[model samples]
Target chain A: MREQFDIPEGVIYLDGNSLGAPPKHVAERVQEVVKHQWGNRLIRSWSEGWWEAPQRIGDRIGRLIGAAPGQVVVGDSTSVNVYKALMGAVKGTERTEIVCDESTFPTDGYIAQSVGELTGLKVRAARPSSLDLTEDTAVVLLNHVDYRTGALHDMKALTEQAHDVGTQVVWDLCHSAGVYPTQLDEIGVDYAVGCTYKFLNGGPGSPAFIYVPKHKQATFENPLSGWNGHRAPFAMEASYEPDPGIARARVGTPDILSMLALDAALDVWDGVDMKAHWARGMTLTSLFRSYIEQMTSLEVITPNTLPRGHQISVRCENPAGVMAELIARGVIGDHRPPDILRFGIAPLYIGEQEVKRAAEILAEIVN
Target chain B: MREQFDIPEGVIYLDGNSLGAPPKHVAERVQEVVKHQWGNRLIRSWSEGWWEAPQRIGDRIGRLIGAAPGQVVVGDSTSVNVYKALMGAVKGTERTEIVCDESTFPTDGYIAQSVGELTGLKVRAARPSSLDLTEDTAVVLLNHVDYRTGALHDMKALTEQAHDVGTQVVWDLCHSAGVYPTQLDEIGVDYAVGCTYKFLNGGPGSPAFIYVPKHKQATFENPLSGWNGHRAPFAMEASYEPDPGIARARVGTPDILSMLALDAALDVWDGVDMKAHWARGMTLTSLFRSYIEQMTSLEVITPNTLPRGHQISVRCENPAGVMAELIARGVIGDHRPPDILRFGIAPLYIGEQEVKRAAEILAEIVN
Candidate 1:
């Protein structure tokens, strides 16, 4: 990497998949918001660019994921935005079947379930390996990458298949967007959502983004519609009239401080090539896999030949114990339930040397 | 008055109703989080302390509002929390009539209408002054202070009235909570929501606070049930199980930086008596009203006899023009459409002296 981040040293930190290391420039940006914009400018800050942050950041993120400007907005959490996207899909369709994978992040499925329960639709789950779009399915929801296994889904093919069956798709790109050149537009993604705390590294619990294809913006009215989404928010009007663009997806006031932090994080991504980044990440993971696969009883859960994203996982007898022990040994990946330790290979910070060292440490532990 | 804020020397700020000035200590707090907690701690910050900020800062706010330790939480915007509180209220009641004031903040009415439209219920716009609580009402939502008029509603009496009709009550405490001793339990409020940016001085667009009376926590669930609300969020389980107590109101990852700023803001309020705070605000507002009513065409829109909140508005033929002119002259207040310039008397940093001087300056413009 050309520029250094504020990521911790002396530990092989692999949990950027959970919370990305803070950018070095975020402090100066937050200082500007706290000092000049809010302290001195005060209410004028609303007019001075505060009001447009959701759409502005959304557009910046849109460039990475192939979404057009005005078709995406950055605000709220990933789960909340998924609710909006799923509700938009369900309300627009005549059928009531919403389909997803049983092994995807449970919140995505749980939120889909909540949307169905609250709005009177049926939520169905299938194993990711066999999730074929049925004729009765009005909408399909899927995580672009599995959190436990780092398994990449076939976004373009699955979306096309679902569309052919007359079902709209809502992709949870929480893991896929930051590390890859996601062709969401080329794949005809109807709606999508993702978090910033991951590879995009806005910070822990940072605001997430949502993308609705420009073709669907006018017709899609996902219904947590608050005043910020009002056509004229300052009018103090009584009725809920949504703005014409993707700004309508905004549910409440943008968290200005966190938005500034996320914006600064994007500065690190300005001129990066996604292809090179993902290759660098996968190369490091491959070396680690070779060093440890036969050394221990750990079974690599991630598909070896398929197009997996950067992070790799190993299924073990006691994954949480291994993860905790690794952390105690100064290697920081995460544990997912019964038997998966997800080691995130973030090329932005982690390099070849660190990956080799972490592999040696893990091999020692298992032995 | 002796300590100089980072505000511009010539500016007489009166728009705290929309967005509060940053505390002098916030910049330091932001630096610490961005550099040490987020940058240094990285992902472990969640386990280290970041995850508890919403509740920890919430308890600090509870002290100001006379709430018990576990009733309050800080996250999301005020409008979204209004939706969560309303959904929680409806879930507690089987019959689905939501009775609310049309005069409440437009966000409150919007949420009621949204719940009606999204979940298939009857949302009635009750004439708040009529005190007519009908038999079928499931919930009554009211702003403790009218946003435009600053007319304070009798929280205790109204909540009692709603209870008599077998209806739960939700309080929109945005305008009243921080400025006054908001004894939510004393008023028997089942659920309440408020913003921190105004009288609490938590910077612009800060995260808001939601109060779910511990007694009612078991009867309902937050509508935006994202994973953060799950009892075992890290388990990767496939079911929708909510965390017990008030934590269930939390739907997604919190904005830790924003919540931290709010925490620093609450630090300034540690020794404050909220009743005394309100007395000072009303006293200063009374001075402005007494002065503005004496000269030229300024007509006070807010009733003095009623227990008003922080803000006081006055009428003029071209209020927006005058407001713009006032901004030029460095006295900051907002003008509503048609005829009102709203002067919010924030007692945390304002008192009788500034109020008297501001009124004198206003009278000069009128004359």
Candidate 2:
């Protein structure tokens, strides 16, 4: 698994949460797609393979997230997927409010606001721990892991509470999907969306995936209603009739080149145990946190009492300048503006020694 | 310029109008982007080059389409762009109808129907030649070339007619952009959108481009309001304040791999003249039509009295079988159901010899 990625020599990359390192086979795979499928086959490739890319690649992603075969399909960006899932959840409900949190990813909040404006619903933002899940709430948007603090939420517990109050839930898995084990179906989650560029190791701007439960497929109407979602996309129909299954979530022509890269990237996860992978991530994050706290006075924001996702965050003065110096010293972690410096522990390529060295370098910079 | 593409040997590819052959350099360019920019540079590539891709590549395309600098930006699919442009046009208008034609591409009509349903407007479909442009028409959606018939419309005349009746126009330039010299700015077109896979020779399912005139940028709002279009996208603002320029039309993380291919593909047009390219297209299309007419009894649906686009369509019995036979004989053209055989004449890689051979093959199959 460690040999599956192409991380550069002499650089410790702890930003897999931002952009995953490319899989080792991606360069050769992309060349074949461009030179053979596109160059030789031309338009015939649509029927040959390109047309089925979104759903086929999506099913592979489904396996990692515990979704059924027909429950997840990949297309569009995560922002667009959030809008689709939010709209699909609230379409015919009598409820008048969309509930999200201030700690959610900013794009998710922005999408909620835009969808609320379009559907004439009130968008209410509350603290994550203090959300009042009520009957009037049409949808609750929750992040599986907070992007800035790496704080993991209790997804099953929150979902059960929302269900008790008769409200649907839409989860943003951008920070949790590939590295964390998500039992979406077993947990009875209604809708989930995640980007592939992060821990999934898809290249920059690869298409995002959305998960809808089996029962909700028939009623899911993606508001972006492009032709790809039509019942007979090639039939040249004048009216729009959405496809019946997860394919209905598709909004436009598949970006075949990027989709194919993601398909190849999924090969690295062939037979690994996700539970074991999650254990490794926890061990690595816990080790990094303790090493840093013992060496420096920086405030670690990640909560240690609860199990979290694959990253650790710290607050230091002049965080941006500190991160620049760390990168110059070959320790590559990213800084979110204002005060936070974040490091991701990708279980696939990152190991214990790399985490130890990264912590040592961070202490040297801050002190 | 024909030497620049990687069309297969012994195959006369007349389907560039459907999917353009990959430029010879695209394979190398895609590998560099995946391996170095994405794999080596990691997250830094977003700020280094990916941030400006949509606008920078758009300017290159603008040079070919006669659009001024900062007038075009590329992202999303053609279907998505159509939805964005149509929604942006009718946002504040008092009129309540979207006028299109029955002969327009089916996706454009479907998008119009969807937008109308969302915005409470009636989508009226009339014949292209007899479109009733009145005060009730909020926006007119017109295709520059009929997808099935290869019939080119008089853009300047139709635009002036729409403006005379006080309605704005949105043009679908999918079939006419790279091969035809479109004066979008000169014609005062309000909005335009097109795909890059055809005459632009971007790879399969590459991101599409949208053009908004300089004067219309401030007021335009893409209904798919993703954070990428925010005024300061990295600011992570919760409220949606659109970017003040053509960037407002963008709506998500761009597919950098495909976008970079399109960026390199646009380099093929650096020193070429579009007017000269359009002239060559007319010559090849006219020759193919004459050769087919002299040898076969198929009914040519393309009109000779009017200047048409980069292809010719012929009506024959069992078009699917005819196209199969033609492809078996190494002359590749696509079939649009019911009864049409369509052959594309891309001036970049297609020339007189390929056109003559394709016509002879079609004649032999249909005679």
Q: Which segments of candidate 2 are over 4 A away from where they belong?
A: none
lDDT of 1 by residue, B1-367 (tens): 2152455777778887878777788888888999998888777788888887888888888888878898888988888898888887786456768888878778788878888787566888876687477777888889888888888888888888899878888888888867778798777789889999887878777898899887888866877888888888888689888888777888789988888888887777777777777888878888888878775567899989757889998888788878888888888999876578898888777767777778877777777
Measured by TM-score, the strongest candidate is 2
lDDT scores in order:
0.83, 0.88
Best by DockQ: 1
First chain TM-score for all predictions: 0.96, 0.98
Alpha-carbon error at B226 in model 1, in Å? 0.9
Model 1 TM-score relative to the real fold: 0.97
TM-score of each: 0.97, 0.98
Q: Report how large a share of the reference interface contacts model 2 reproduces.
A: 0.70
lDDT of 2 by residue, A246-302 (tens): 888887777888889988998998887788888899999999999998988889998
